[model samples]
Target: MSATFVDVEDVRQRLGSFGVWIAPMTLLTTPVATQRAQFARIESLGYGSLWSGEPPADSPMGGREAFAEHGVMLAATERIVVGTGVANITRRDPAAMHSGAATLAEAYPGRFILGIGGQTGDSPLSQLRAYLDGMDAAATQVLSETAYPRLLAALGPKTHDVAAQRTHGVHPFMQPVEHTANARRLLGPEPLLIPHQFLMLNEDAETARGAIRSVFGSDAGLPNGFYANNFRRLGFTDDDLLDGLSDRFIDAVLAWGGRDDIVSRSRAHLHAGADHVLLHPIAHDLTAAVDQLELLAPLLHN
Candidate 1:
């Protein structure tokens, strides 16, 4: 399989060293102006891209439609790239996803990326293959020639192969820097690798960890869970899996401490071969998330 999308390097440059991942805009009934304002502020702070996803409204992270939010964010900022860290494939048909993504890419030009995932198929790869087929069939000439970047929210080799062959690369969330190293080895140094890092500005380990747990811990340890399976693949123990996650597990997955600690953590992923690391600040609301990023900007921005 060969890649139809070929503008990977340009996308990498636009992503810079760190981009933010949050759903504060669509998570609430926040005014569009406010959404634009917050996005503008982050761009002004010198962050490269701002990533978000299409989570269900009732989801613990709060729901926001990916494309709609991407549009608003794109309209709000002039330089910062906006991406759907993933728009759930299970939630929309291929044609709809293609149309929405193309519209954004055309409007935003090189500033938008159509990162997609969240498949519920029995045969995950086969299911995603079909999904891409539908999306491709629906593609327009402008979109095909635009070469707007795309990615799969993949964590393992199989899906990484799919991403390498089809889209630009993979966006692995909830994994550590080691996962970035392993993904780089799997991708063999060309395909784009953007891993999401959970960050908290809290000083106390327990408080910071508790915030991450409230967001991702409940879904761990499931026999059929993707994140739990990814954890095992990364060599975390069953002991690390049980009892609200071992301290080691929490430490590996979440970056918490002073400015230097968080900055070093992001650098670790970049050193591990990630082209860009999407920083997910563990905050209860948009205001807090934005404030945290501002505090880290002095050390984090490239």
Candidate 2:
């Protein structure tokens, strides 16, 4: 896909690396009314985008309409870009994914951004590589003629390079600031670098860590070694994964505490060169997640 290059400086000035992702499972689990409310609230909070993660499923809603719902949410306001923090390359053919993204872009105008990534869970390496290669082709095809900005949910070196060469930049999850720094270097001074960070707000170290572990335990064993290996690279031992997050481990990876504390941690990523920070609150309750956003507003609004 051919794409007009997004000005790295423009994206950085506007976003400052602080977008948020509402995973599909989480969004579906939350009542539709509540999700709509959440979208409106997030836009009002001055966030740049409402990101969605699509799982590999043979469903229509899992396609463009998912993020378009986010655009509809943005219609309730004036700013805020909406994006599929990623639609897997494995699930849709590039032509189809490109068409869906282009359609959404046409529907929403500049309010849409396209983010793509490799599928996690179980898939053969050969197939995964094909998917990544397809991503490169699809991104070029989509962006070749349009102005839509593209990002990759990269987890390692090669994927990171793909982000630099073919797309706008990278959006890494379950990664440390160290990776953010590395990503910036690889993408150079021109790519839009945004990384998603898990968030919480408890002061008691163990309590905060436990919440993370509960989520991680369920998500970590997926076929992708990216998350688990990244944890180890950040000093987390396998033993740390068996039960729950250790205080030391959680302190290293998650952003927790008061509004100022969380904002400070978020800043660390920006300082490391992320153009946008995609916030994923570690909570199930919609109200609780909104509360976390409220806590974050004071820090981010300035």
Candidate 3:
């Protein structure tokens, strides 16, 4: 049997003209209880989807029972879709991933979205294609039992094509709006085109730059060399990398300042052809994140 994508009408309803991307609550930082609260709050705030991750440190197969904890969050809210914006493909055997994503979809019905990604390495293409094949077989097996949606956390042509041919859409991370335009052109009109936007609500030059630097300093030169290299292509120099994100680089990559400023930057992503925008607040403070969401809620509607 062929693999099943998400039901278009169902996805459209869940999207309801507003799509959201949220940061994953990592094991070190946000606890499950805290994650539940945050997801519930974001759902109340009118965001459409809550996205999280299964990083390398976590179990690779992306457990279905893990999301079961968030059942409290899902139960507390209505109309929000919950996604594993990427549970890495390399971490799990095909059957394990299939069972995990399948269980979540069966349990939640239309509310679950499974997003998959390839882990970083030299032979990423070979590994990613194999992962896609496994993911397809998994989806077929699960969708035979029940319907669910899947997406790929894609950055390049090959994965984007896999997402187009196999799943519902593509969710590209840390990419600029121009990338969104290019991805839309690649994925065409039918699939979901959700992009993650990092933001800071402070306009103070030093404070914003410090925040961006702090965030990127921790992330750059990591295993994901491609993402860092892409930033270089976007004009980040060695100085920018060593000193951390320059003001220009920060401004180029992140949306910063007050509500109006953030919304204006987000509009560019939507205008560039994104079907949905997920906002990742760079702030460590939860209240600040919530406040930013409150401020950005109006923009989500438009």
Maximum-TM-score candidate: 1
Model 3 scores worst on lDDT over the 10 consecutive residues at 57-66
What are the lDDT scores of the predictions, listed in order?
A: 0.82, 0.70, 0.69
Candidate 1, position 168, lDDT: 79
Least accurate 10 contiguous residues by lDDT in model 1: 215-224
lDDT of 1: 0.82
- Candidate 3 lDDT, tens digit per residue, 1-302? 12654566668677654444544443235565666676678888788877666555354333333355445445656768777767667567766766776777776778877777756677876776677677667766654666667778888777778778777888888888778888999899888888888887787877876775664464553223667666665556766655444566667778888878888888898898887787877657555576678778876666
**Order of candidates by TM-score, top first?**
1, 3, 2
Off by over 4 Å in 2: 1-5, 58-65, 68-76, 120-145, 217-224
Q: Would you give me the overall lDDT of model 2?
A: 0.70
Q: Candidate 2 on 202-274: residue-level lDDT in tens?
A: 7877667767766656345322267776666656686664445456666767888877788888889989988
Q: Per-prediction TM-score, please?
A: 0.92, 0.83, 0.85
Give the distance in Å from residue 193's predicted Cα in candidate 2 to where it truly belongs: 0.9
